[model samples]
Target: MAATEHLLRQGSFPAFFGIVAIATLVIRYLYPDLFSQSPISKLPYVGTHVGLPIQKKISFMTNARKLLRDGYRKFHIYRTETALGQCVFLSRDSMVELLKKPDEVINFEKVVIKDFECKLTKLASSEPIVPHTIRSDLTPGLVRIIPRVAIEVARTIDNELPATDSWTAHNIYDKLLRIVAISAGSAFLGPESCHSEEWIQSAVGYTIDVVTGAVILKLFPSFLRPLAAKFVPAIKRVDRHRAGISRMMVPIIRERKEKANTPGYEKPDDMLQWMLDKAPEYGIENDEEMAYVQLGVGLVSIHSTTSTATQALYDLAARPEYFQPLRDEIAKALQESGGDFTKDSLYSCKLLDSFMKESQRMSPISMVIGKRILEEDVQLSNGVFLPKGTLVASPAEAVGNDPAHFENPDEFDGYRFYRLRQKGGLQGNLNQMVTANKQNLAFGYGKHACPGRFFAVAEIKLIVAHILLNYDIELADKSVGRYPNKFHGDACTPDTSKQLLFRKRLSGQSEI
Candidate 1:
C-alpha cells in the first residue's frame, strides 16, 4: 500500500499526460504505417526507425555521411528523415534516368524555394528573372564580367589580407567568404554598390539569415511557424536586410529603367541591368521584387563559391606539393593573356581546374546533389516508385568517391582531371570542372544544373589563381592535416573556425 502510494504521487496527472504524449510520438515514429497517415510512411528510411523524431533528426544532422554511404550500399532507393522531412536518396546511376524527366515531373525550383522558407522569411518567391538573366545575359557577357570580377578580387585580397612576408594567422574561410561576396558584388550588384559596406553586409547577412531563419522556423510546429517567424531574431533580420536592399536598389532600378530606351544611353553592364532588362516577361513588376531577386541570386552564388574556394585552398595548403605546379600554370596563363585574367586565360589553367575539381570530389558542397521535390508520382527505369510530394536526390558524393567512376578515388590526385584531359575527345570535354556529367555532379546535372557554373568556375579559378600568385598558405597549426570539415545534414563545408598561415609571396608574378 505504501509503494503504490509513492508511485501514484510520482506520476501525477500532468506527468501522466506528458508521458502519454511522448509515448504516442514514439509509437508513431516506430510504427509509422499503423500510427501515421503520411504517404511517405511506407518508404524505407535511413537509420533506425524505432526512436523519437528528435533522435532521428540528430542522427541525420550529425552522421549524414555515414548514413548516406550505408544507405547507398544497402538500398537502391531509400529515404532519410530530417528537419526537412523525408528525402528519398537515389543511386548515382539514376542521374541518366532523372535527366530523362522534365521539370514538370521532378521540380527543382520548388524544393529550393521550400527549403528556403521564402513564405515565412520573405526571402524570395519564384522568380525566373534571376536564372533567366544569369543564363542569357550574364553568361555571354563573361568577357565583361571576368575582368570586373578580377578587379574586385585583386582589390579585396589586398584590402583583407595583411601585406607580410612572415607567416600570419588568418581565418581563411571568413577572408575567402568576404572576398567572394565583395568580388561577386561587382558582377551581381555593380561597381558603384560593390564597395558599399552596407550592400556587402546585407548580401552576406541575408544569406546567413535565410538559412538560420529556416532552421529555426522548422523547429516549431507548422501551425506555430508564422508566429515563430515574426519573433525569431534571424527571421526578423532577414526583413531588415530585404528592406535595406530595396532602399539601396530602388533608385538604381528606376534610373536604369528611365535610361533604358534613351538614344545615347549605353546600359550598365551588371546583373541588375540584366535582370531589369528581362523582368517584364518574367512578371517582375516592382523594383523591390527585382532587389529580392538579386538577393536570391547572391544567396545561391556566394555560399557555394566561398565553400568551394575554401575547400580547394585547404586542400592546397594541406598538400603543399601542388602549389608550385598550380603557380606555374597561373603564371603561364597570365603571361599568355598579357597578365589579365580573362575567361580564356583562366580556363587555360587546366592544372588549377583539376586541383579544384579534385578538391570538390573529395569534399563536395553536399553529399547528395540534384535535390528535387516530386511534382507527381513517378517510377524510375528500375521500377522504384516515388510518390508525389516526396523529396528526392542523387548521391553525387558517393559517385565522386566510387572506384568505378574515378580510379583510386580516395586519393586526392590534383592532376587527375588534368591527366584525363590529355586523353582528348569526349572524355576531355566532360572532365572540365564546369561540365556536369554522371560522374561529376559538382554543378549538378540535367537542364536544371547550376546555370551559374561557368561563371562560378571562372570565379573560383580567379580567386585561387590570385591566392596562388599572391600568398603561400598552410595550416596555422603546423602539425595539422587539412582542417576537418563541418557537416550539417548532407551539407559539407570547410571549417571556418580553423585559421591558416598566409605569407605574402615576395617575388610572385603581378596580381591578376
Candidate 2:
C-alpha cells in the first residue's frame, strides 16, 4: 500500500494526461482543415520551416503583398491557410462571376457575422433592415439629405477646425473622423441627439470598438471566436458603447412610439423613425437593437468617408498646385449657385470630383470589396470549384493600377478622369468614382453594391468644397507624397496619426 501511494504521488497520471493533450494540440494545429475536402486542403502551403501557424502570422504581418502577389502569380485563384481558416485569392477577372451569385449562394452577412462574430458581440447584426432602410429612403432621398449633410459639414468644419489666417498643424484623419462623426450622427440619428456631446462620443466609440473588435476576433479561427471574444478588450468595449447609446436613444424611441399612438401625430422622416417603422416586422425593436442598427449605418458612412477625405486631403496637400485650381472651381460653382450648395453646384465642380476619384483609386481601403464566405459548394465562371466555407475576394488594386484601364495608372493625375469625362464617351461614366462597375469596385459592383454611395459623394464633395473655399492647406512634408495606408492582411486604412498644416485663406480671396 505504501509503495502504490508513492507511485501515484510521483505524478504519473498528470504526465499521461499532459502527453495526450500535447498530441491533440499538435494534430489540431498541423491539420486545421483535416475534415474538409476543399481544394484548400491539398494546395501547397506558404511556409514549411516555421510551420503553417507561425508562418501565416509572420507573412501576413510582415509582407502580405509579396505573399499575396506570389500566390496570385502562381494561381489566379489559389488558397492560403491561416489560423483564421483558409482564404482564397482571385484575380480581377473573377470578380464579375463572384459578384453574380445571389446572396443565398455567396452570403456576405454570414461572412461578416462569422468573421466579426457579430452574433456573439452583437455589435453589428446580420439583418436586412439597415440595407432596406438605406435602399428605400436614404439613397433615393439624396437631394433632400444633401442639404442636411451640407449644413452639418459647414457647422462641423467651423467648430472642429482652427480659426482664420493662422497655420495650425492637425492630425487630418482625427479631424475628419470627428467631423464625420458629428455630420454622420446628424444625418443618421437626427438633429436633437446628434448635438449631444455624449452621443457624438458614443457614436465615434461605436465605430472604433466594432471595427477593432471585428479585426481582433478575426485573428482566431471561426470556432474559437466565441471563447476568445471575452478576452478582447475592444469586443467588450462594443457592449459598453451599445449600453451608452441605448441610454441616449431609449427615451427618444419611447416618446416617438408614444406620440405615434396619439391621434393625428406625424412621425419624423429620419433614420430613427425609419428603423422604428421596420422594427415590429424585423424583430429588432429594443433600444439596444435600435442603437446597434443605426451604429451599423455609422459603420458604413463615417469611416469610409473620413478615410477617403483624409487621404484625399493628403493628396491635395502633397500637390499644393491643385489647391488654387480646385478653389477656383469651387468659387465658380458657389457663385453660380448664389453662395449655396445644391445638386447642380456640387456636380459642376468636375475637377474636384475627378480629384476625389483619383485619390480613392490610388488609396483604396481594401484589396477586395464585398468579400464573402461560400455558404455551399459553388463553381466560378472560370471553372474553379470553391467548396463550402471558402473565403474569396476579387482584385481591387490590380484593376485600379492596370494600364489597360486608365492612362498612366501609377501616376496621380488629378484631371485624368475629368479629361476623359470632357471627351464623354461610352466609358466616360465609368471614370466617375461613384459609378460602380466591373472595373471600378471602390463602391463595389452588382446588386449588393453599397446603397449609400450617393449620400457619401454629396457629403464628401460638400465638405471638400467648404474647406477649399475657406482654407489654404499644405502637407507637412512636401517631398514625401503621402504616408502609405496601414495594411492588415486584406484590409487597408489611412494612418489616422498623419498630420497636416492648414491656414485660413488670405483676406480678399473670396471669389463667390
Candidate 3:
C-alpha cells in the first residue's frame, strides 16, 4: 500500500503506468484471492487484472460491463481483486452454494461493516444486527404506509418538478435523491419534522458525505484508511451533517425521555420512535447513536431507491415506446385500488414492476453481488475451497445478462420478464422487483438479502407512477439513448448528472 501510494503521488506518467501494470500483475494476478487464500479450484483463473491494459483503467472504472461479461463467460469461478480486498467472483451455481452457508461460516454482516469501517467509523455493532423493525413491524403495516408514502411522493414531485408539461431539461438524479430522501423521510423520521429543509438536506448530505469518505478511504489499504481518512475533510463533512441531525432530534429524544415511564404515553408507530425505543438497549448510547440509525436507513434506502428509479426513468426517457404502456398500467392499477397507491395497487402494477426489474437487469446498480467474507474456511458445495477472510462476490451484472440466464440479454425488452413470468408461472416468485434469486441478485441471494427491498419496490413504483401519470419524458438530447450508467469500483449508480426533458401531460391526473 505504501509503495502503491508512493507511485501514485510521484505524478510521473511512467510511475503511474508502472503502478497499474505491476499492481495488476502482482496484487491482482500473482496474488489473487485464490492464489493468496489457498483457493483450490480446477477451473480457469479469470481475473480483471489479467490481460487488462493500463489504458483501460479509466474505461473500466466507469464501465466494467464488457470486462465482467467476458470474465464470467470464461470461468465458472474466478477471483476479482478490488480496492478494499480481493473477492472471488462466483458463477450462479457457486453463489447458491455460498449463500447456503450460515452466517457463522461466511459472515457478510461483519465483513460488510468492516469494508466501510473507515467511513461510517462509529456504527455501533459487534453482533448480528438487530433487524430493523421495518421488516417485522412496519412491513406488515406497509399497506397502511403506502398512502402516506404516496402523499409524500406527491408533495416532493410538486416541489422538485415543474408544472404540467413545462418542457424543462433537468438533472433528474439530483431531484430524485431529494424525492426519495424526503419521501422515505416521511416514514423514517416521522411527520412532525421530516419536511424541514435542514433535516432533508442533512439526511441526503450525510449519506453523500459518508460515501465520499468511504470512497476516499478506499484508495488506501484497510490498514492505512483509518489513520489517513479518519479526520479528513470527507469524514468531517459526515460529522458536521450528523451534528445537524442530532440538533434536530434532541427535542424529540427529550420528549420521548419525558414520556418514557408516563402512564398515559403511547409509543409512536414510526422508525424514529423505533430507533429511539431500541436505542437504549441497542446502541443509542448517545445522541450520535440516535442519528446513526436514521442515517443508516437513509443511506441504503434513499441512495439505492434513487439509483434504481433514475436508471428506470432514463430507460423510459430513451425508449418512448415504453412510456404510455407503463402509464396505462399504473392508471389501471390506480383505478383497481380505487385511485390509491395501496398494496393491491402495487400488485396490480405488474407491467411497472416488470419495467423496474428489466431496467435493473439491463443496468445494475452494482457490478458484483452477494459479496461475503469467509469467516470459517470451508469447501463450497461446488467443490471450490475458499479460505478464511476471502472476499467472495458473484459477477451479478454478467450473470443477469448471460445468454444462458436471459434470452435476448443485450436488448432492452421492457416486458421480457413479465412475459416470462406468465409463461413460466413465476408469478409467485422471481418476477417481482423485490424477489432475489440466483438469476436476479440485485437485492442479493440469501438469508441476508436486503431487508429494505420490499419498501424500495413500493417506493420506486409510486414515484414512477406519479411521474408517468403527470408528465411526458424524453432524453434532453435524442442522441443520448441508453448511455451506460457510471461505475465506481463494483458499485454502479445512475449518472444523475445527465439531463432529461419533461413536459407536463394534461392527462386525467395532474400530480398524484
Candidate 4:
C-alpha cells in the first residue's frame, strides 16, 4: 500500500497509464504469455526461467533436444524456454487430445507466424493461399506433371553428376538440393522460369536468406528488430530476391492473363497458374503478392524435399543391399504402368515407399510436432489446462523412437513399414511416407500436417527411383556408413558437407 501511494505521488495519472502501457507492450513482446496468469507457469519448467532469462534462452537454443528429452522423462507436461518465447511440451498421450482441438482454440497459423517471423520477413500471411493451391491443384496435377518432373530430375542429375564408370565423390546434399529446386520449380514456376539460373538461385537463395535473416533478427531486442532487419545482410538479400522474383513473375503473370481467353490458349498445369487462379479468393491482389506466395511455396517445398531425399540417399548408400530390391521394384512398377512413370507406378513401389518412410522415421525432421499457440483457453482430455497465448507441442522424436510403438525401434530397418503393410490391415494404410499419425509426425499431425507432403513424397520417390535406376552410390569414405545428421536446437538436417561416391551402372536400367 505504501509502494502504491509512492507510485501515485511520483507522476500524473496519464503519465502512469502511459508508462504501464509501454511496459505491457514490452512484456507481451518478451513473454509469449503472462507469467502470473498463464497455466504453463504453474507447470514444471525444463530449464531455469526465473532469473538469468537470457542464459536460459541460450541454453534452450543450443541444447533444446537434451532439455526436451529431460522434460519428457520428468514431466507429463512441461514448460521450456525457446529462442522466441516459452513453450509447453506435452507427453505422447496428450498429443491426440491436443491435435483434436479446432484451430480457433489451439491455432497452428499463430505458431507459424511467431516461429517464422512471417510478418517481419513478409514471407507469409496469417492465412496463406499456397496450402490451398497445393492440396486442391498441385497434388491433383501430379498425374499430369509426373513425366515433366521425371525429365527435370533426370536433366538435373545428368547436369550436376558425372555419368562415369569410375566413382566420383560429390556433395550429395548440394546435388539433391539442385535437383529438387529445378524439379519443384518446374511445378511452382513453370519450365521456362526453372531454366533460368537467376530464378533458381533466387528460389534457393530466398529460403536461405529468410532463415538467416530470421536468426539474425531474433538476436536483437524486439523493439530494435525492425531497425536490425533493415541493415542485416541476409535480410537485405531477401528483399533483393523478392524484388527480382516479382520482376520476373509480373511479366509472365501478365502474359498468362492476356492469353487466358485466346481461342487456342492452353493454361499450364503448374503451381503458378493454380496460385493465380486462387489468388483473388485469398486477397492476394498484385504481382508482388503472387511472387511472395510462390517463393513461400518454394521455401517449404524445396529445402524439405531436398533434405529428405538426401537423407534417403545417404541411407541407401550406407545399406547397399536395399538398392537392387528398390531398383527391381521400380522396374516392375514402371513396366506395370505401361513404360511410363505415372502416379500408379510410383504408388506401386511399396518397398521404395517403406524405405523412404523408414529413413524419415530414423532421422525425422524435428524433435517436436503439432506446434500450436493457443488463441483461447484449451483443456486437454487429461484435464491439463492451457491458457490463451500458450505455445505447445509434443515430443515427436521420443515418440518415434519408443519401443512400445515400433518393434526394435533403434534398428534402422529399411523394410520396416513394408513388412507392416504386408499385414493387410490398418497398418498397411498407416505405414506410408506421407501418412502423419501419432506414430509418424515427421510431416506433423492433424489438419496442420503439411498439405504439400503428397507432392513432396511423390517427387522424392521419383528422384530416388531415377537414382537407383541410373547410378551406383556409396559413401565416399568406405569406412563411414551413413553420415550422421546435424542438429541445431530441435531441428535435424542431413549433413550438407558429406560427400557420396556415385558411378554410372554398367547396364542402364529402364527409365523410371
Candidate 5:
C-alpha cells in the first residue's frame, strides 16, 4: 500500500510539470512583449505573459481623463486604433467641421456600432439602411406621440411609488430603470405591453445585456468576438433576450399586417402601426422583417431613454432642495392648463425642461459626439487637416464643463439653463453648454442631430414632473457615494450600480 501511494504521488508531479511547461511555451509564443519589462508587468498576478491585465486595468474613467488632457493641452487631437485596424478617435475642431458637411461626412454607424453586430445580427448587417429608416419612419412617430406617452408614463410612476408617509430611502437607480423601461416600452409598443411585467423586464434586460455585450466585444479582436460572445455571460444573456424579443414582437407584427391589408381597417395608435405604414416604402413588406425593425427600435429607444431617466432621477433624489422648485413649476403649469397633461402643459413647465437639460449637461451619455469618417481631406477653421477615413468628434463633456461658457460648471445647478433663458439668451447654444453647440454635439448636429430630440425631451419632462408631484424621494444611504460619472473612452452612461430610495407623498403634504 505504501509503495502504491508513493508511485501515485511521483506521477502527479510529472503531469503538473508537463501542463506548466506547455502553458509557458504558449504564453512565450503568443505574447513576448507582455512578458517584457513594461509598466503593466510589474503588477502582481498580472506579471505572467499570457493574460491581458494591463489593458483590462485601463478603466474607462482613466482613459477618458487622459484623452481629455491630450485633446485639450498637448496634441489637440486624440487617435486610437480600433480592433478592426481602423484608426479611430477625435479632433476638437473636426466635430464642428463634420456637421457642416453632413452629406459628405456622415456618422459611420457601422464602425461606431461594430461591437453590437456580434450579438444582434440584424443590426450588424443592415447598416446605412437601419439608420436611414430610423430617421425617416421611427423618428417621426416618436416625435408625434412622445407628449401623450410621457404623461401616461408619468401618471403610472406617480401611482406606483412605494407606500410611505415620510421620505424613505430606497435604491433610486433600480426604481428609475424600471420606470424608464416601462415608459419607453409604452412609447414603443403601447400601454398594453408596456405595463406588463414580463415585457418590461424583458426589454430592460435585453437592452442592458446587449449594450454590455457590445462594449465587451469591442474590447477584443474582431475574429475572437463570435467565439467569446458565446462564452461571455452578458453576451449569452443578450442572445437569449433577442430571441425573447423576436418571439414577443412576431405576433404583434402579424396582427398589424393582417389588419393593414384589410380595407377600411381602424388604425391602431402605436409604433407598430407607424412601422407597418412605412415598411412598404423601405421594401420591408414582410411581417417578420417589420417585426425585426420594431425590435431594433425598442433596443435603441429603451436603452438611451432609460439611462437618461435614471440619471435625472438620481440627481433629483440626491438634491432635495431642487425638488420643490421643479414641483412648483410643474404644478403651476398643470393648474394653468386645468390639470390636463397635454403637449402645451408640458411645454409650459420650463423649469422641468431646464432641470432635465442641466442633468443631461452634467451627465451626458457621451463626452464626444459627431463621429464621422473623413470622405476626403477636410480642413478645419483651426487649421488642422484630417486625412481620409479619420474619425472625428467634439469633446462635449470638457466643453460643457468649461468655465468660459458655464459659470460654476462643475456644480449641479438645476436652473442653469433657466437662468440663461431668463437673461434672454439662446437656450441650447452649443458653445455655451458642454453638449450643445454649433459645436456642443450632444444629440449630434446638423441634419442628423437626433431628429427625435423634441420627443425625448418632452417624454423626460412629463415623467419627472409626475414623479415629483406625487412621490417623496431621498437616498437610501447617506454615506454611499452619489452616481459616478460613467466613462467608456469618450462615451458615458449614468452609473447603474448606484441606488436611491423613495416613498409616496401623502395628500395635503404636497410641498410644492
Candidate 6:
C-alpha cells in the first residue's frame, strides 16, 4: 500500500508540469512578437524570415538604375537582423574617396582574401600574399615576356582553328579554354611541359574544379559548412583533380632540378624558371612543393584570361562591323614591327586595348568593388561606421554605369578611352577607368590591384590579333543580337554557351 501511493504521487507531478509546458507554447505561437524579442529569434528558423526583408530591399536598390530611368546618383541603405549590416552605395564623389584610402581603410589582402585562404584552401599556414606577391612576381615578368608568350600560344591556337573550320558548329567556350590553357600554361610553365596533353588538361580541369568548389563552400554557414563540404561531390572532384596534377608535376619538377644542377645547361625563359628562382625567398625549398606554387599561378592565369578572351571574342562576333577597324589596327601594329608580335608591337595596338577595356566595362567580373571586412571599428568619409567583421563594399556596377562619370554608359563605345588618350589627357586617368572608382572596377585598385593584369592584357591582345589575321570568324547563330548575360549575387558573366564560326582567311585578305 505504501509503494502504490509513492508511484501515484510521481505520476501526478509529471502530468502537472506537462500542462504548464503546453500552455507556454500555445501563448508563444499566438503572439510571435513576444518570442521575437528573445535571442531564440536568431536561431535559423526565425532568422530566415527576418533576413528576407533586408535581402529584398538590397536587391531592389542594386537593380534600380538599370531597370528605372531615375537619375539617382547614390543611395544609403541599412540592414538590421540581430547584427548590424550597414553599407553606402556611392556613385560620383564618394566613390573616389572610398577607393583613395585602400591601404588605411581597405585591408583587401586581409579582408577580401581572408575567407578564401582561411576557409577555403587553408593556405594561411604562411603569411597571406595576395595583392603583394601577385604584384611583385607578375609585373616584371609580364612586362618583359607576356607578348612573346602570347605570340607562341597564339601560333598554337591558330594551327588548331583550321580544323574547326570543317565542322558545322563548334563550342566557343571549349575552344577558348584550349587557347587560354595552352597560352597560360606555356607562359607559366616551360613549353616542354605545356605541350604535353596530360599537363594542359589536368591544369585546366583542376583550376576550374577547385575555384568553383571554393565559391560554393563560401556560401554556407560556418558551423554546418564543414559537414556539408565533406559530403559534397564537387569537393571530391577538386581533390581528385588536384591529386592528378600533383602526380604529373612531381616527376617533372624532379627532372628539372636534375637538369639545373647539370653543368652548361641553358636556363629556360618561362614563369616556371622564375618561380623556381623565387621559391627560396618564400621559404619553399622542396622541388615538388615549389611545383605546386607554379600550379597555383597556372590556375589563376588560365581561368581569368580564358573568361575575358571568350567574352571579347563573343562581342566581336556579335557585331561584325567592329571587326574591320580592329583588324586594321592589329595589322598596322604588326607591320610596324616587321610582321612580328613583339612586346612593343603589342602595346602599339591602342584600338585593341580600348576594345578590351570596353568589353570589361560593359560586363565586369563582379558588381562590387574592393570587397572587404572590417578588422576593427572604422569610419568612412560618408559618416558610416562599420563594426568588426562587418562586410563592406562599393558600388562597382552603379559607378561604372553612372552617366555623370561616363557619357552614355549603357552603349558600348570602343573608341571612348582611345579618343581620350589621343586628346593628350592623362593616360594614367584612363587606367583608373578600369579601377574600383567612379568609372570601372575590373581589376580592383591600390595595393590590392590585380598584379597579373599587364600580362593578361598582353596575352589577350596577342591571341585576338593572331586569330583575326589568320581566321575569318562569325557567330554560328547570326540572329543572336547580344551576348547572354549571367548574374550571381552581384557579379556578371558573359554567356559561355554561344558558338563562333571560324574559317581560314587568305594571306593577303587578313590585313583587310
In angstroms, the error of model 3 at 262 is 4.4
lDDT of 5 at 292: 59
What residue pairs clash in candidate 3, if any at all? Answer: 164-504, 165-503, 165-504
Give the TM-score (vs. native) of candidate 1.
0.91
Candidate 1's residue-wise lDDT over 1-512, tens digit each?
Answer: 56545657887667666766997876776766577666556666778566666777778888888888878767757778765776888887776687568889888777766777878988655667777788898899999789889988988988999768799999988888789888988998788787776787788889999999998887777888999888899988988898988888888889888988899999888998877877778887988888778788878888889989999988989998888888888888888999888999988888899889999999999888888888888877877777888888877777687777788988889999999998999878889999977768778776767899999889888888888888888888757678878888889989888888888886754444
* lDDT for 359 (candidate 1): 94
Clashing pairs in model 4, backbone N/Cα/C closer than 3 A: none
Estimate candidate 1's alpha-carbon lDDT, on a 0 to 1 scale. Answer: 0.82
Looking at model 1, residue 322 earns an lDDT score of 87
Model 3 TM-score relative to the real fold: 0.87
How many collisions per candidate?
Answer: 0, 0, 3, 0, 11, 0
lDDT of 2 by residue, 388-467 (tens): 87877665765677677777888999998788889877657777778888767888887878887877888889888888
User: With candidate 3 superimposed using the best TM-score fit, by how many Å does residue 392's alpha carbon deviate from the native?
Assistant: 0.8
- Give the Cα lDDT of each candidate: 0.82, 0.76, 0.75, 0.82, 0.63, 0.62
> In candidate 2, how many Å is residue 489 off?
1.9
Tens digits of per-residue lDDT, candidate 6, 1-512, equal: 56546656778757666666987776765444456553323222211223343453354434533421222332322221211123334333544555566455555556534434335542232333323455566566665566567666766776556534353355767777777777777766766677777667766776666656656665555676677778766667766655666777778777777899889988777666666666667687776566566556666677777778887888787777877788888888878877777777877777778888888777766655666655666555656555565555555665677677789998988887777667655654564233333344667655455677877777788888877777777778777566676765455766777778887664535673
* TM-scores, one per candidate: 0.91, 0.88, 0.87, 0.90, 0.79, 0.80
Q: What's the C-alpha lDDT at position 439 in model 2?
A: 69
RMSD to truth, every model: 4.3, 5.6, 7.2, 5.2, 8.8, 7.2
Measured by TM-score, the strongest candidate is 1
Please give the range of 10 consecutive residues that has the lowest summed lDDT in model 5.
Answer: 40-49
User: How do these models rank on TM-score, best leading?
Assistant: 1, 4, 2, 3, 6, 5
Error of 4 at 10 (Å): 26
* Global CA lDDT computed for model 5: 0.63
Error of 4 at 418 (Å): 0.7
Error of 5 at 36 (Å): 23
lDDT of model 2, residue 130: 81
